[model samples]
Target chain A: MRKGGVVVRDVDSEVLQEVVVLRFLRNLFRRKDTVEYLREAWRTKPSIAVAEKLFHRLQDTGSPGAALAFIREAGRAYPHAQRLRDLQHQALRVRSSEEVKSLRAALAANPRPEIYARLGELYRYLGHCEEALEIAREGIARYPQSGGNYLAIGLVHYSRFLKTSSAHDGLQTEACLRQAYALDSASFKSLYYLACLYVYAGAKPMASECIARLAELMPGDNRVADLAQRAQALPDSPQGTAADYFRLHEARAMEAAAGAPGRAEPFAGLRPGKPLNDRLARIAALPGVDGVCVLDRYGARIAGAGRSGDTACNEAALQGMLEGARVNARRMSIGNFSRAVLRSKDWQVFLYELEPYGLAVMGGRTARQDLVQRKVTEFIEECLCEEQGA
Target chain B: MKRILKELNRTAGIRGSMVMTQDGIMVAAALGPDLVEDVVAALASALLTTVKRSFNQIAAGESLSELVLTATDGKMVFLDLGNAYLVVVAKRDLALASTMVEIQSAAHRIKNRRASTVQRQTAAAR
Candidate 1:
């Protein structure tokens, strides 16, 4: 039998009979008791079909949080169930929209500073930059001393700065964040954003000061430590903008989703169109390029082409080199480790951090480093574009 | 040797300079107040040791002539000498192309100084 678009085979007859009874009860009474019964049935039987039905019933009953929880649990148990994951994402979007609507209603009924700040932050998270800015401006106009509104404004401009790399946006971000910090020196968010801004702007002294303040505030916090490490490893010339950073993170999340035993069409736009190996192969074919490989943070080869005969050994060595560089860079408080060039008599090896993955390209010593760097940039851009278009 | 490091430290944006063995032992250092001599030496040694091991594992009979690590806040350049490595730490804005000349010159002077000292020891023994 087909129910809720999920095939109902392999289900026990007793369970199916119970589900039928619950459906009848739901249709007749539409009571909370019916939902309880469905939940009980799901907990007892725990089949994919039942889980889907339970999720729909939960949503109908206006318990999206419960529905999301159930769907996520089902997703983990039945990793092959793409339908559940889709429903989960759908539920999240619906829930967020519903909350937004309610929050808007609440603000319309009674305008308040916190609400405006919150709405602005929500809009920012949703990538509604204009709306976020508008809301934050409203909040600032009413509650000029509210650091939250200033932070929201700063973040919107920071996101814009990341996207546009405009000097004005950068300046606006700095000004807003500085105002926020001045309003509340002990605010963790304020300090964190200031530190991130300084680090990106290559203002090492300012970045270091903010980081030091954060360390004092949260002495044992791992995030503070991570921030410190990032400060040390920052590249001399930081590249990419907010869009690039978010896209890479989104791509990684989708990759994890793809790993589950299900179709990943929901994230099709962010999935890579071509296999990474094919892309690496194209890079290897570049003139004077000896080899190319992508290694995970741990140094495991994710993909490669034109590698030497001792691929395993070479990968291990590369991993070791990356680790050492990362450690040293952090200890020195440089920024964040971006890239390194290893030179020998016969070859030059370039290693780049692509966040969760690292790209290593080996080229003959005769190759123009600038040309090789350009090719690598092209390859990275292609990967990002393919992911966005896929 | 210390004088060479001190001179190298004078270069714009260079915070400190040091000479260390592949094993992480500090021979000499001219570091800024913000830098600790022991910490810098230890870190440099650890990095060089790892790089050297990587080269050995490849077994390609190739030795690293130079390594440059560029971070967001600063940059470190390592030049291989026969017996020790010269490690220089500078700010991110360090004009590497222009500053490398002075750095290389300082490395050369250190190498020459070591060579002369070895020669003097050999002559004394004879």
Candidate 2:
């Protein structure tokens, strides 16, 4: 989902499934009477799953502090429930929207000046600029000399200015960036963000000046270079906007759907399609065939045919290819990655990066995984060496 | 996953290896015995979002392919594997460049295989 002009996709469901499963079974076993019955069954011959069942239950009840004390008890041995709780909680909670809520309470507690500074950050993350300002104000009022407090206020104003399009808001944004600059002359983070604000807000020269100063402050940092590259490369129209990436996404989705067994049985000699499926038909008839496809960056359809089981339905496979190109060159100590191969349950993807983008091949036949790899590599090299080959 | 952890710990000088989704799910992880998966997943998700925000702020785009954190104890490297992330924590005593190279190569292999599978399926559908 896109919010505040930024697209945020839903969390992967597979991991959620596991957590849900844990919760479900925990519920089944935690009934007051059953806990006693199972506690005895677990004594004679304790099972790992059963032990874990009781262990996870304690976490939800927040009785981990006491449960852990019994971890050394034999049979239905309790787990280091508290430790598990701490680890699980840390892994899950930090980035959640709840951070904003907790920080609200943290603000109410007024625990310490540091607490307020942190709470101010939480408010900004939740996009609660007004709340952030109020929190920062109180902190600053308590400690006017604290640079972090000033920085927090600056962030809220700058954030609001960016979100709102009115002329009034624009002025407000400028005022905030200025206040931020005056209050924290030594903070490059404030200066750098101000530079971005300037660039997006149409103050290019001022943006450049701010960037130059930021660069001076952190000469070793590559962030400025990275930002400059991306900004300059921005696409011009909807055709080129991030949405255009779906061309490739659709092609991939199609391939996966075709591979679905419910769609069609495998054709011995020919797959059904105007033409694209013919090449796939021939390959399918070959022994040990599962599924197949060819693709390029941007998720466009190129050609071919297959079973949904044989195809890759997961969009992450596309991302994996792009990442492969990056890691191959960086980690392999190789000067470049002309082609690469990826293997997983029931499928394989072979990708060859070309100028601007690249081509990819997917199939489920793992009988000769190496051959597929070689073919992809050769095809890529041929295309590059002689355009006529493609 | 065990083999991967062993390899990183040995050849790549990784102190730990974790597999997590961009949206705060822990798919797999091998950390210190004291650590727990849910905790790792949660903390990593928070950290991942923070990094992604940084990437967006810098105009480097919406995704973060990798991130490296250096501390007194060692180095931690994050590899963006599309929907999932591979996190490698290296001992401070290890050389940064060498370990990074090893982890990078491994990540490449994993991504390439995944892409090939997707491409094959895409082709059949067309």
Task: Using DockQ, give the best candidate's number.
Answer: 1
Question: For candidate 1, lDDT tens digit of each residue in B13-113?
Answer: 89999998877788899989988988888888888888767865653768887888887578999998878989999987676778989989998999999
| Fnat of model 2, as a fraction | 0.00
Models 1 onward score TM values of: 0.50, 0.28
lDDT tens readout by residue for model 2, A309-372: 3133322344344444544343322233344444334444444443223444445435364454
Output the lDDT of residue B75, model 2. Answer: 51
Q: Write the per-residue lDDT of candidate 1 for residues A24-125, one digit (tens) a residue.
A: 987788753367777887788888888888899989888899988888888898986645655665576567667778889999999888888888877765
User: For each candidate, what is chain B's TM-score?
Assistant: 0.94, 0.79
**Residue B54 lDDT in model 2?**
31
What is the lDDT of every predicted structure here? 0.75, 0.52
- Tens digits of per-residue lDDT for model 2 on B1-126? 545655666774565777788887876677766456676566556655643553343222435555554332345567888878887665544555556678877677667766998999999999
Best by TM-score: 1
Model 2 CAPRI rating: incorrect
How does candidate 1 fare on TM-score? 0.50
